[model samples]
Target chain A: MQSIERLVLLGTGLISGSFALALKRARLVKRVVGVGRNIENLERALELGVVDEVSTDAAQAVRGADLVLLGTPVGQMGRLMQQIAPNLPVDCVVTDGGSTKQDVCALFRENLPRHLAMCVPGHPIAGSDLSGASAAQFGLYEGRRVVLTPLPENDLLVVEWVRQLWVSCGATVYEMSAEQHDGIFSAVSHAPHLLSFAYMNSVLDRYNAEQCLDFAASGFRDFTRIAGSHPDMWRDIALANRDSVLGDLKANVAQLNHLIQLLESGRGDELTGFIQRASRARIEWGKPKKG
Target chain B: MQSIERLVLLGTGLISGSFALALKRARLVKRVVGVGRNIENLERALELGVVDEVSTDAAQAVRGADLVLLGTPVGQMGRLMQQIAPNLPVDCVVTDGGSTKQDVCALFRENLPRHLAMCVPGHPIAGSDLSGASAAQFGLYEGRRVVLTPLPENDLLVVEWVRQLWVSCGATVYEMSAEQHDGIFSAVSHAPHLLSFAYMNSVLDRYNAEQCLDFAASGFRDFTRIAGSHPDMWRDIALANRDSVLGDLKANVAQLNHLIQLLESGRGDELTGFIQRASRARIEWGKPKKG
Candidate 1:
């Protein structure tokens, strides 16, 4: 694989900064240019050696870059793409570390139409409560999974190049359509997050909420861990993936109603069965994966 | 602090065994007699010093006991109480480590009417996925919280004795009504378990469930950790605390419905506010308690 001469990072935060660090460690990139609105974060990225250079102007940063990574919230990616489109090298491969892909695919089409053949929308399944350039680490993607949703116009070689780059950063890459990615993530990630948030709100609304929270133990801590997530980022995700998220949320409500019916009817046998199914599946899922 | 001459455990399991171990360590008990249908567990309790002796007969176990701890499930407590009613010494102080207090209080009223002054229903907040005699440890209740719901007919001294015993076991004890105990636990523990189970079932209902499970990460794992709980145990809790659990579940449904409505109408601002409310409350709840 050809090494990246100049790699431009649209958002120099945990995801993109870590990617830059990993690529630098693997000696797969010649220079990394960190671009962000926050000058302090850019300076931190430079000091941390996550990037060889820093730029507040995305267009200037992408002028001579062979690769551009859009590693920001889905809401910010479109604007970033538009800012760099006029100056992006024609041969530059554009990819992303966004959590949601369908909206990102649309953004790329809307803002970088001429670079569609080089755009490969991707999502790295790595997440951390910590953010900013300071949270970047060289091994963040080690043993992580990355899903790439390539457009029909995407060059096959360019897609393979992006996949190999992530592999070099120690990620297992899988290919799927943007629609499939949204559905899978909505079921596994987006819906669960929303459910956790809603459950937290429900607990807070109780008459003895303070007492309830005081008595909450490990179970409550683990169940609501994700409820402590950043509000703005999750809001963008909830809005950006609205359709898939809504579908799964409705499915969850249907499940709750069915469970309520079982409880109301005092059907002990059915309730046991209901709980057993979930318990068995979760236990099975928790087992170490077999190679 | 009158040292118990004989401490009888109605069930040789984690809660009871731990209580016996804690009391033995404090030298507050002279003998511990473990009674269980499973001869192996009883023998294991005896061998592990969780009990001084083992018995298969609850009536025989309480014959010379000064204190009897009914550590069996709520469903079995009534039967155990009935069995020991005839053989229990007049001066014996009978208490229990049942999770739900109202039902246990009723059990005391039904079978040990003459022992009402000595019947103190309590709940030890310590829980583990593991069970059986081997899982019991001397410090299991160290720094843990124990809530005692004393019956109005009970002698004040008897409640104080129970509280002191728990304190000796390295626990902080609080007094509350059985109704309040049930309501609080239902909101914090029981309802969360049931909701997690329901959420897991909902995810399993998806056509891409296996794929989704394969791709699930930390958030899914933490959210569903409680869903892997023992089905029979959680089922009993859901039934025993039926009214409170049902109310909380319904409230959760209402919250989800409101969220779905916002998402369906594309109300991004309102949706952000909803998530923000939950996120802020959870973050606050997670902070260290003020001195």
Candidate 2:
């Protein structure tokens, strides 16, 4: 395929930096400009050779760029899109690495309305608790899944190019509508994060929280692992996907209330059945797929 | 340390089997008799040399035993204590690997009234998702923590004997009241498990359950890891530690309700503060501590 002559990364972090590294190894990009608010992170990106150059200016960095990737948190993407809009090349295919997509699709419509045909919204399913340029690795996306939500007005050619580039990075790309993407992710990802945060806060609210934390072992570790996620990014997600996340959170509260009733009334058999169903389903889900 | 002339394991599983293996390796046990309802697990215990002999009769196995470790679920421990009480040597010291100590203490009081002076209820903080006789390892307790709640009627000599044995197995043991042990474990271990189970069940309740599971990534996997735990064992724990577990569940529900109010009102700054506090605390708790 054709090479990306100039690639501008809006945030020099794990997801975007890894993408840039993988594409460079595939010989798919010529020059990369890493832009971020954090000078240290941008410098690290440069030191690691994740980019040909580093810039503190989003607008200046997007000048003459053929592909502009918005990799900042969802809350900041709209502002970045606005900053780069005036200088963006007319035919540059714009995309974002936002976890929640519908809000991003709206950002494109609001800030880059004229560039809708060249815009694609995507989420790369790769993250540990780690973040920033230091966490970037070329193999991060190998065998990982990327979901792309394309606009109706988007050019088919641009969408296909984006898909092919992700494929070149050893990622399996799947296409879905922005609405579906947000709903599915809220169920599997966003709500769980919010729930973890809620659980952590509850534990902290306890009078013996210090004692509780002191004795926390493996179960608490895994259950609350995501409670340590970046706050601003998650705050944006919770608001952006408000309806679905609210639904799931409400459903969880309902489940907890029902469980309380079981415990209070001493319904051992029903309690066992409830636990058995969930345990069986989780075991089934955890099993290796036959195919 | 005087070697245990005979070591009796009431149930051939991870906790008790590993104890036997560790004691054998330390030359602290001259013989180990594994007793269980499941013949296969007992046979596997013998095959793995976790036991010198296997029996389906708890009473017979406890005959002439100097040390008896109750390793089954707390629900089964009562019946096993009653069975072994008929034949246990007068000087034999009894301990348990029950996760909840208060209930096991009550069980000992009710079933082994004559043996209270020799009873010690314990919990070993070592386990993965794995169980069964094959999951036992001599090194399982290495660098791990064990909590022992000794009955007021217990002899200091017997308690010291138990503590030394665990230290030989490479464990650091702590002493606490059964009430304190139950309260702490309910906070850190039992409640998180039920929350996971409740969350999994909530997801399964959704119409798009399969679709949600299809796209579940790392966050969901870690948050729900304990949901796949053995159902009956967890059921017993929840019931056994009902009061503290109920308090935690209720506290979590209150937290979620407040979170829902925040989400419903669209209080972005307040939401950020909530997440920020949780995020900060979790990050702090997850950091490696220095002496």
Candidate 3:
């Protein structure tokens, strides 16, 4: 095993940038090297003290690194893996910060040389909509959940090392199938975002029709604020996890339709019970996790 | 009008408490009488300087008031109006800070005396779930929107006076039909709350089933935090504006279902377009309004 004298993080956006900061803070790694398409972002990462060095060449960045984190968007991961897979040294642990694990793992399996047993597909469920290294903060992963989906053929040491990385960043690790991860996330995160986006559109349409946008208050602000998320990133997420997200969308619609039908039927008592049950459940389950 | 000496605010919660602060800041009223059932809340409001005085007796508090705001939950408005209606002086301008206007206005029309032309139904689109007068802060209404729904036969001077009061508090006032007001709010505010509540319930169910609660991150926090809102207040809102909320619920369900079906059919282009449109619309509508 090559000693991890240097760490190469691909695509230093929020997650990678945060990982860089956490690694530096924990003194887990000696040198942090950030690689991204945007030179400005690479410069910002260095300025923010998130990385010890910056590089634009994907292959050169990963050539001698003991650890490489594919932190690019899911859609862009395939191309990134293709560029870095050949240069990745033997016994070097490789992981990712992608939301969807199965596809990223598949990409690595297809592209990486057979000598690499260290590739693991992982996801850290700790991020804000804000992108780029500038938005990265130290506590981003504090007390958050990290899921590692390891291939059966992959060495257990790689999985453990990947887990340790997130743990150092203050994440609680979990083991799960990539399919399960995708489905569960689609239900919780993707569906809610899509709903928020669509709801904002409807309100904006109505307000624009009546020229009431200026009359909008904090209520509107609170509901649609998440709609301001990075469009390109979300676009990629929605498309990459299309199947699972679609399933969640169906469930969400069914739930809302049931609510609407009950209301249309003037079933106040049932509607009240439904909402009451939902409210009680949410109040009980929605407490924040410790960082 | 009788000499304005004292001001009494009923139900010293978020809106009332903020108004109390605004009134104190403006020095418009000589004294603030806070009436509520929770003694702790009353004391806390006093401790927080949200009110000059606190009381539990609805009638006693309104006896000498020149201006009184009924700041109780909408469901309790009818009963509270009955208790305070007979005690209000002839010259007192009785206005409410309830969200649902039509029902509250209907209650007032049936209960209030003819001389109380100052009885106005108000819906201030400002506030957070953190309730009670202690949550009150000055500048709460700055750049917020306040809607006043008055009956055609109601005194115009009284309506203008109520409008002027919110104006003084830095809110932009708009006049509209109670139906229109409820419809708009149901779409923008009430439905969003219900969605948040329901989504949080789903998250909780998953947590209970598989222990995923510990893994929730900023995305889940941002989406479900609002689910911790006051259940009683939401119950009142859902019950009072049942029909309009139901309409919005159905519309939301349809929108969600349409997106889901498109994704299920693998129509990436259409889904992308939909999200892009929604994102653009939300971006345009997301300008910050006052707290």
Candidate 4:
């Protein structure tokens, strides 16, 4: 087994910083070097001991690194890949923390060297309402799922090494085709966020129309809390995962309209039953243990 | 000003227990008496220091109390109101912690003594995903909104006393008609829950169809966390506030359909822009406190 002692963490925001913390907490990585656009964020990540050192240059951060974790916004991954491709270590296992896989994997294939069979795309299912380095905490990945989409052409040893990295970080590893992973998350993750954002904005618009802030209550607060998450990151996710997102959006709206029609026809029982079914399922899923 | 030395709290669950803790924390009441259906809950309230004493008898708890808080569900409020009406002191100010006001206020008016003109209908706009006495905590109402809807025929002194009570408990008080208050919350609070519940159920159904449990990530977890809250309580809320919830549901679904159309038609910019707008508004609303 290859020892992932030296790790390069690109982007020290919620996802990257959290990956850093998770790695250290699980004793999976001995040294972490963080690279990001924001110097202050890098300083904060270092100050929190999420990383052993920081660098402004992506190439410098990637040098001699055993594992490189790309946690940038999906839209930015392509540009970063092109910039770091030339300097990437020959045998280094490169992985990403992008939520949307299709685009990031496409960029990795387009930009990286042939030896980049070592490139593994990863998406850890963990986060909070907070963002940036300040919100980064250890144990964020404990018991969380981490999905990996490895190219078929990739060496088995490299794939297992990447899986071992995430497994060591306390994340349960699941492997799927990039297309399958993208479609699933588009329906489950990206689509829900789009709806939440749209639903919250719709409520805000109504409140603004009444010229009253009175409508902002506990329900609205809970419903719209995710709306306060990083906008740029979401925008990138939506755009990169456009096809799946569009399909999911269509299905979601159709579902919502079905509920609306039930309400319009005054079918209280049907609506109530529908909500009850969903509530029961959600309860069975159980609360995600707080870190 | 009427002396508020001892406070008597009915229901002793999340709302009542939190109120008890807030009262004690603020030193607004010298003692708190708890009444509930379950002795265990009452004991839990006592254990949490939310009350000085516990009683299963509603009438016994109400007698000689300067302030009596009815924190039962809206559906049960009328029956409980009838039960304690005769035992309530003529001078004791009667208030409730129920969500829906117009219905609860009417119940109070029809059941309580006509001579006791100090009945106040209040809905403290504060709560959590957890419920029952065990979930109650001190300072739950700190910096939160509490809507007080006073009837036209009610004495001003009664309204002011209720206002003073909540003010002393660390809440900013707002006054509105019972009808208006219900309408506003129906659009914001009740409606959001119904939508969230509906969305979550849809996801669960899809998850079942695909035979995929591993696919549910943090996005699904956060999106449906509230779905795990008390089902009976939510069932009552949906039934009692059906009209407004239905109306808001219609509006929300319409808004969702509008975004879906944009995405389906390949207008990625338009779709992403809407989410960005929603995200910005959410951030503005939930901005972290300034130093």
Candidate 5:
């Protein structure tokens, strides 16, 4: 694999910084430029060797870069894409580490129509509660999955290059349509997060919430752990993927209603079977699998 | 602390075996007798020194025991109570480790009416996915909380003795009405488990369920860990605490409905605030407290 001359990161943070560090370890790039509003974080990223140089301007950072990674929250990707669009090199390949894809693909088309052929929207499945440049580490993508939802106009070589970059970072890359990606994630990730948040608020609404929390044990701890996620980021996800998320949430409501009826009617056999299906599936999912 | 002559465990599982081991370690019990339908588990309990003797008959086991711990599922407690009622020593202090208090209290009233004065219904908050006598350990209850929902007919001395016994095992004991215990647990424990089961089943109903499971990351893992719990045990809890669980499930439904409205209208600020409330409360709940 040929090393890129310059790789620029927009919104240097956990996802971007980790990608930068992993690529640097693999010696896949020559110079790394970090762009972010937080000067302190950019300096920390530079100090930690996640990036060789730091730039506060996204446009200036992409001027000579052959690769640009949009690694900010989905809400900020559009403006950042607009900022770098005019200055990006004609051959520069663009990719992202956003959790959502369709909105990102739309942002790319709206802001960088000329660069659509070089743009490949992607999502690295690895996520952490921790954020900012300080949380980045080498090998963060090792054995992780990255889903690429490439645009229809994307150049074959550009998509291959983006896939190879992630592969070099020790991640297994998978391809899917933006719609499919959004739907799958909304079902597995987004819906579960919203359900957790809703459950937490419901618990908090109780008059004896403090007492309830005080007595809550490990089960409560694990179930609500995601409820403690970053509000702004989750809100962006909820809004950006509103359609798919709403569908899953409605499905969840239907499930809960069915459960309520079963409990209300004291259907022991059916209740046991309902729980049995879930238990069996979850237990099977937990088992070690052969390739 | 005075030691009982013999302690009989109604069901030789994690709860009962752990209690017996903890009591033996504190030298507060001279002998431990384990009664279970599974003779293999009974033999394992005896070999591991979790109990000094093993019995397959509840009536035979409680004949000479001065302390009888009903440590089975709530569904089995009533039957075991009926079996031992005629053979239980008049002065035996009967306590239980059932997760649901109200149901267990009713069982005691229905089957062991004559033993109510000596019966102290309790629930040890410590729980594990692992069960059977082989999963018992000496320090399982150390630093754990045990809620004792003593019946009105329970002698004050008997309640005190039960509290003291838990304290000797390094557990902090609390007292509350059986109603309160059921309500609190339904809100925190039972409701979350049921929601997880519902969510899992909802996912399984999807056409691309296998793909969703394949891509489910850490968030799904933690949120559904309890969904992998014993179906029989969870089904029993859901039915045993039906009213409280139903109320919570309904409240959860309302929360989900409110969230759906916010998402449907694309109310970004309100969505952020809703997520913020849940996020803030969950973070606060996770923090170390002074008390």
Candidate 6:
């Protein structure tokens, strides 16, 4: 594979910094520039050797760059794309590490319509509760999956280059439509997060909320762990993937209502059967599988 | 604390075997007789030194025991109580490690009316996903909490003795009404397990369930970990703690409805507020605290 001469990372956080580190370890990039709003984070990125240089001006940072990775929350991608559009090298390949692909694709069309041929939207399957440059690591992408949703106007070579870049970082690449990516993630990732947040809020609404929390044990801890996620980032995800998220959430609500019916009717056998189906499927899914 | 001369553990599994091991470590029990429907489990218990003797006969095992701990599912407690009632000595202090308290209390009153004074219903808050005698460990209760709901007809000294025995095994015991114990556990433990099961089943109900499962990341793994729990065990708990579980499930449904409203209206600010509330409380709950 051809090596990247100048790789620019916008919003240098866990995803971006980790990407930079992985590529550096793989010797795939010559020099990387980190761009972020926070000076402390940019300095930390430089100090940690995640970037060869740091810049606060994304437009200036993208100038003459051959590859640019938008590694921010979905909500922040639009403004960043708009900022660097006029200065982005016409031949530069642009891709994002956004969790939601449809929204990011829309942002690309809205902010960089003329550059759509070089713009690719992607999602890295590796997720963590941790954030910022400090949480980034060299092996964050190893044994992980990355999904790329290429626009109809995208240059096939540009998409292939992005896929090869992720492969160099030790990730298996999967391709799908933007809508399919949104729906799949909504079912497995987005809805579960919203469900956990809702469940936590339910406990908080109880009159004896504090007392309830006092006895909350391992089950509560695992079930509500995602409820401790960064609120702003999740808010962006929930809104960006609204259509798919709403459909999945309503499906979950229907499931809960069905459970209530079984519990209310005192249907022991059916309830056991209901629980068994889920247990079996979850246990099966948790088994070691190929990426 | 006066040591137990003979301890009969009915339904020898993780809780019962762990209790016997903990007692043996503290030199608090002279002998422990394990009783179970599975002869293989009883043999394993004996081999692992979780019990001094093994028995398939509950009534025979309790004949000369000074302390009998009915360590079984709440559903099995009644049958075990009936089996041992005629053989129970008047001086024997009977207790249980059942997860649900109200139902066990009723079982004590129904099957062992004559033994009520010696029957103290208890719940060791040391829950685990692993089961069977092999899962037992000496340190399982080293820092765990035990909630004991003493029967009104129970002798005060017998209750105190039970508390001392748990303390001897390195546990701190709290006294509470059976109703309160049931309600609190429903809020924290039972409801979360059911919620996880429901969420898992919702995914399975989808048209692209397999694809969704393929894309599931760490968030789904943690969120649905409890869904892989022992179905029979959870079924017994959900049914045993029916009223409280029902109330909690309903409250969760109401929470989901409110979240749907927020999502549908595209009220980003209110949705952010909702998720932030849950995230703040969970973060607070997860911090180190004095038990």
Model number with the top DockQ: 5
Better model by DockQ, 3 or 6? 6
**Can you tell me the CAPRI class of model 4?**
acceptable
TM-score of 6: 0.98
Docking class of 2: high
The alpha-carbon lDDT assigned to residue A166 of candidate 3 equals: 83
Clash list (residue pairs), candidate 6 = none
Per-candidate local distance difference test: 0.92, 0.92, 0.77, 0.77, 0.93, 0.92
DockQ of each: 0.85, 0.87, 0.45, 0.39, 0.91, 0.87
- lDDT by residue (B248-278, candidate 1, tens digit) is 9999999999999988888878988998998
Residues A1-291 of candidate 5 have per-residue lDDT tens digits of: 778899999989999999988998988999999999999999999998889999998988899899999988899999998888888899998999988999999999899998899999999999888899999989899999999999999999889988999999999999999999999999999999999999999999998998899999999999999999999999999999999999999999999999999999999999999999999999999988679
Native-referenced Cα lDDT, model 5 = 0.93
Off by over 4 Å in 5: none
Worst 10 residues of 6 chain B by lDDT: B69-78
Best by lDDT: 5
Off by over 4 Å in 2: none
**TM-score against truth, every candidate:** 0.97, 0.99, 0.88, 0.80, 0.99, 0.98
Give the alpha carbon lDDT tens digit for every residue of B1-291 in model 3.
222477788898889989878867876667888899999999999998888899999888999888888898887777887888778888888888887888887888888858447787888888585777777889999978889998876789888878887888898899998888887777767888888776665554453334444444455556666666776677678778988787667767767777767666767677777778777766766544356
Give the lDDT of residue A260 in candidate 4: 60
Give the per-residue lDDT digits (tens) of candidate 2, residues A165-263. 999999999999888888888988999999899989888888888988988988999999999999998999999999989999999999999999999
- What local lDDT does model 1 show for residue A266? 96
Query: Which scores greater on lDDT, model 3 or model 6?
Result: 6
Which ranges in model 4 have alpha carbons more than 4 Å from their true place? Answer: A3-69, A79-93, A108-116, A128-144, A168-170, A208-222, A258-272, A287-291, B4-12, B17-68, B82-92, B108-116, B133-143, B208-219, B288-291
Error of 4 at A270 (Å): 5.0
Q: Model 6 segments beyond 4 Å from truth? A: none
